[model samples]
Target: MSSFCLSKLDHPDLAWLAADRAVAADDDPTRTAAATIAVAQALRALGHHHLALTAALAAADPADDDTVRGTLHLQAGLAAAEHGDRRNAHDLLDHAAALADRHTGDTDPHHTGFGAAAVQTARSLAAHRLGDTAEAILRHEHVIRSDGWRRLPPEHRAAHLVDATRAYLDTGRPSRAGRALLDADRTAPAEVRSRPVGRTLLTEIIRGGPAAADVARLATVVGLTR
Candidate 1:
């Protein structure tokens, strides 16, 4: 269900289904935390920032395992950023970073990227949301070039690159955005094609006027043929 929702982000109904299942299996903190984070991300994609934050907060468990704590805090921070609460977002993200550093750094558990790189990516996204475009770009660039990036799961790696695409878009660099999106798509078409942000970024690139051949090719690959 999560895969379907993630791959077909144009369809929010699927996300709703995944969110419900995640909430239903609430007996396990690890499962609950991961699901809640996924729900929060889906809610964010659906433009329900408040609901997303609420969902992410539900993932919190001060006594849970390191992965759960770090994942929940990261999700909460991301949703907080989307909710326009920069201070809370930074605090939560910083906490998440500390937890991740003490745990596994940047590793994927339950297919959710939770750790140092995830914290940094969330921080970059928060920075972008809060209008610190240059910082977002720089942070994202470093992540993209690091060994950590190479170690990330394909979809996870793609998601971070797509975030970088937003930084470029903010700075009026359609060509750069185009390249970044294409790079992500090359890594994981399911991640890029199924993501709301991916679709929107591609739309923006298309609207920004003549994209390069590689970008155009990626648009077709991702089914953004319009």
Candidate 2:
């Protein structure tokens, strides 16, 4: 699926596409921010690392604000890390973390972004990437507890759960990952819940059982034309 479809406003990589579309379509600031972030996220997911980085940079300096610049750096750094470019990732992440630190007096969760909660989640993701296990865990826990998350749309919540599951798996907590994935599947639409990762995780949980139907359904949901 296209990255635009996957990146929801409620999620951190907030509006790469919406922002861009807004500018292109009607010059709406709201759409511009959303489209820019959405497109940036989509590019990152599709492995267009440099494109993601560029998009983020452009979005950050729309009005040349330091805060927005820092946020974009944070996102670009994360995307770079995911693409296996640790050097650039570290540089960019450190830049953002530094800005966040300076502004909030130690990378405080209440910095600035789409929402306090979303900003905090982004910081947590950065910490997770930087191997700051304790901070990452604390921040993620806080996110789970916050009203912001509870008030999000179902698809947005599912996306967050997917990130949480990945974080759990990364931290060597497979059981937690499994449970989180199941929860995400429950909240997601059938089309989203039927992806390979979701299906495979479910199949593994119910090994040697009647989950073949589920697996098949997953294949169909993801439109695996094979």
Candidate 3:
């Protein structure tokens, strides 16, 4: 049997990609910052909380007060959300959003929506878990329209699409969820495609028993190995 797993969910390649890009673009501080965020997000996704925290801290700029502080808070908020600390997560996320708003008029590109979509998405998940369906739906809808997803690297964009797909599913809108899953599947590479397909299949499973041929087809498309 193959030792590789489709559900393993590690992001070593993303970390490597980010690090390589950061090194190659050392002259561009904004690219470096963005790469740092990517590294942090990848680490966070892979359950390396300490590494993610360290990366976030390292990404902070001592000179640029507002933007740097906001970025750090946003990173911290993401970590907090991952750890299930909703209250602190929301507080830090809101703080980051406010800070971002304050720096929006600045010409610097780094002052943009730094992790706000992730924060809102986390909040939406929390709200859903807490049975606050309306708030969850509203937050997810807002995040779906946000520039954060559009601004992300293509891989991260696919990942966010998966997240957004789940958000739609949690709102009991299976059709919209399926569409989001399809989008993610279309954009994702062979190695990453299965996650979205698995999610889509779960809906099918819930409704009734999905055909083995259908499941096998999706597995083939997704390359069921990690």
Candidate 4:
């Protein structure tokens, strides 16, 4: 369920499916929390901040395993970031980093592929959302330049690059944003092709930059020619 959701994160129907799964799994707190995180993310994208925050908070559980806790905190941190609550976002992201530190053990069914790198990648995202474009790009650079970067899952890396593209655009570097989006597509075609934000970013680049011709090719690949 999560794999599908992650793959087609732009699909509103898939998010609704995950939310329904959460409802069906009322007897399982872990599943409920995990599902809620995905739902919250989708809701946030659709401009339902209030509902998204509520769903994100529902994922929290201090007593859960580190993976689950980290995932929940990550979602909550992202939601807070989107809400412009810089302080809350930073604290929650910090807590998620701590949990990720303790994740040198077994994997759980609820694992969202979050780890130290994921936490750091999340810093770039939160920073970008909070109008700290410089810090956002700087934080993402740490992840990209890490020795263990190659070991990180393609999906996670692609997500980071997508967020990095946003940071580039925010910092008035549309060409760089175009390059990052192209890099993201190379990293995970499904993630880029199916994500609304990815396509939206490409559209903005095409409409707002001198690199429109260069970005237009990739934009066509990402189905943005429509």
lDDT against the true structure, per candidate, is 0.76, 0.59, 0.57, 0.76
Model 1 Cα lDDT, one tens digit per residue, 1-226: 4533553566665776677686786777677776676676677767787787777666676336677667778777877887789898889898898887798444456666566777777788888988889989988887777666676668777877888888898898988988888888889986677777788889789878999988887777767774
Model 4 residue runs over 4 Å out of place are 2-14, 106-108, 209-216, 220-226
Worst 10 residues of 1 by lDDT: 1-10
Selected candidate, larger TM-score, 1 vs 3: 1
Q: lDDT by residue for model 3 over 4-52, one digit each (tens)?
A: 1212244455554655466367765555555566566566666765666
Using TM-score as the measure, the top candidate is: 1
Q: List the pairs of residues colliding in candidate 3.
A: 5-226
lDDT of 4: 0.76
**lDDT tens readout by residue for model 4, 1-226:** 5634643555665666667676576866776676666776777666676666667666666336677668778877887888898988999899999887888764766657778887888888888888888999998888898754666779778878988998888888998898888888899976677877788888888889456565788877666674
Candidate 2 lDDT by residue in tens digits, 1-226: 2334544323324344443454477454433544455566666656677888887866666533445556677668778766667688778766776665555422323123533455566667666666765677678788878866664456656766666666775676666665666667678754245444555554443443343444445445545313
lDDT of 1: 0.76
Model 1 Cα shift for residue 118 (angstroms): 1.0
Candidate ranking under TM-score, highest first, comes to: 1, 4, 2, 3
TM-score of each: 0.84, 0.59, 0.58, 0.82
What is candidate 1's TM-score against the reference?
0.84
Clashes in candidate 2: how many?
A: 23
Pairs that clash in candidate 1: 105-116
